[model samples]
Target: MTHNSIRVHYGKRVVAALFGLAVAWGTPVALAEPVDAANQYLGVWNYDQPDRADATDIATVGQFGINPLTFPQVGTIEFTRGRDGEIIGHTDQGCTWHFRVNGDALDLTSTDQYCFNNVIGSGYNTYSWHVTVRDGREQEVVRANSYLGYGTFDFELTNGKRTRADAAGPGDAARLFTGTWMFDPTNPAYLNNLTSPGYQPKTGAVRIDSNGTGLIARTDDGCTWTLDARGNTAELAPAGQTCARSDGTVTMAFWSMSSDGTHVYTVLNSTDPQLGSYFIGSGSLTRQP
Candidate 1:
């Protein structure tokens, strides 16, 4: 081939290789995965007290007895991992740390030691961040060492109350409460695996007025209840026999919803208390005519 023709062919091959490289690199940049829109930080996160064998062990698990907890002391422990497999955590108290995965949960120890490295040697001071994510949110109750006994430790993630989920007076509370709700009377059973001795699994409906002050709830067994803007813990009383043919009355208190209004949770203290006292419950409800 002529020298000029050889030079031109070589130049063309270089341009083609560069073009292919650009397309290969640019495709991934153009089609990156969408960020997860779920703000896991928004909803309430609860964990039960871990069943520790002793007080010293409890300290190791990082439990301080029944006082107001700080973000570091209490609240969700956000986990962050690095590309190199290093791990870190952020908690409500604004504290950050290196963590190790102990099974399904996290163990937040001092930054000095490594998780896999410590599996065989001397023990160090550390706290357990035993938690589970449910419904895309972390549960507050965590088991520090083992799951055995209960502790008096309970926490609210709203920081110091009046969270966006809290009753923002009548206006906001009403807007949130006004919705169409279908009761899956079986949900609690599904979670706890316990059934009431006499009650059948029946469904129901609830309608909240826009004024944020009225409620009309009906049971599938043919019972109803009406509500007016009244108290913090409103009684979910049955209107009459037509409303509830069942054995006991239903009561609800501390009603609240997430910022997105997609999920609703309440502290329902049933006379029967289906699962137990202080039943923390949730349901899927949406706005409607």
Candidate 2:
């Protein structure tokens, strides 16, 4: 198989492992007050890594075929101030932890465990997080020990208080996405497997018209686009039209952009497993001048 195909297969396995780990971590901790000495860790803080992509170590594989390095950028983690003044953290990835903070040192242990049979084989796993926050930044160490193997990941964080503008609903699409956008070949979000045959272009440009229509090169000529004003999310799909792919005809294949209007977050797979092997690709696209 090709290099991209290998990555795609591994990527699927990694995603499965992430969900398994999240399920194993159990539910969020209930609100409680922390000791007088540990109240400083309260409130939501954002993970910040100036060199996140570069910091990720893809060489080592953890349990369930996951790489711990990418965890920081994948989801949000928020710490809320409990009524009693305790530090409680909730992660968008479905895990929660209770904090025991002492000055700059902190300890966090998972409240649950999960087992699964994955690419890394069948096994059970547990997690623990240790962190230190100071001087407008935090350093965190996550340890994942499983029956298969043990892995550690480090992350940094800074305050991420939302401003009045950020909390506001989506702005006009013409202002947010109607422009020239180019896909970044080096930072692909997802790629097609080799079994899926297609001309997967890594470098190309696309234009979103002012009236919610998209014109992309080397793919479907055009498609109807919709943007949710409430959430800055956008979707591009042929809708009623059928688009041709290398393996088969696709009518529902679409690309979904997250709240970030600048990047394409996901691309629906075009391949029909029962029909045969054919996969589509997805990746981030940056606006061009």
Candidate 3:
């Protein structure tokens, strides 16, 4: 299957603008205390590099490719303040990390030892996260040194203006999908393997207003799209371009929000002969706070 690059010019512009604003605002205050930086880490963060293992060839060396020891290749990491004042880090894959801010960085250790062993590895492994707020956006750098190997991941997240999951009401469903959603390029579940080398996930957002009409933004190759919402389902399509499968069949994009509105299940199905008769891209999106 021949893959076409989606122009991501819009996302680039937004980042450039925000970076300028951050610079104009002067140097961000360096929080020497991890506890003091807790508030800065509160919110949902999307991975800047969705293809986790793509960072280095060694990443694909062993079971590492299929079994990553870090957060899912392409998903969201949500940080929230626990009732006890400890910071909680939640991954879309169902693992939770209890964070202790030690100044400039967070010391993360799994709360669910079982889930931790399953995703990361067995035995003791520690994760460190360093967060920096530029302008109004947040950037996180995570490093893990475990038996699997040492790896580092970076994330650049936009402020999605969302409340904590527990505080969200049912009515927020209509507005729940209104944030950035990314495709995991390395997740085999999200690609049509037979037809292409790999599908590059598009990074974008669903901007919904009170009036209910908004556009879907993709940052890969800068493709403009729009979205229509009805209840919990959102239908996405190219704004003015043609979206046809390899077999000449038209394609459509849609996403279904989970009941709690914290997760979004997405599907983009198309057809391609070499890539297979159908190209179905499936993944999850986490709401940003």
lDDT by residue (tens digit), candidate 3, 94-149: 46778766566555544223234332222333344555555545455444433433
**TM-score, cand. 1 vs. native:** 0.31
lDDT digits (tens) for residues 224-263 of candidate 1: 5554332121223231112223565544322222223433
Model 2 alpha-carbon miss at residue 164, Å: 14
> CA RMSD for every model?
16.4, 20.8, 20.5
**Candidate numbers sorted by lDDT from highest down:** 2, 3, 1
**TM-score, per-candidate, Cα-based:** 0.31, 0.41, 0.34
Winning candidate number (TM-score)? 2
Error of 3 at 256 (Å): 10
Candidate 2, 170-195: lDDT as tens digits: 44434555666776664323341121
What residue runs in model 2 are displaced by over 4 Å at the alpha carbon?
A: 1-39, 49-72, 82-86, 110-126, 146-180, 186-284
The candidate with the higher TM-score, 1 or 3, is 3
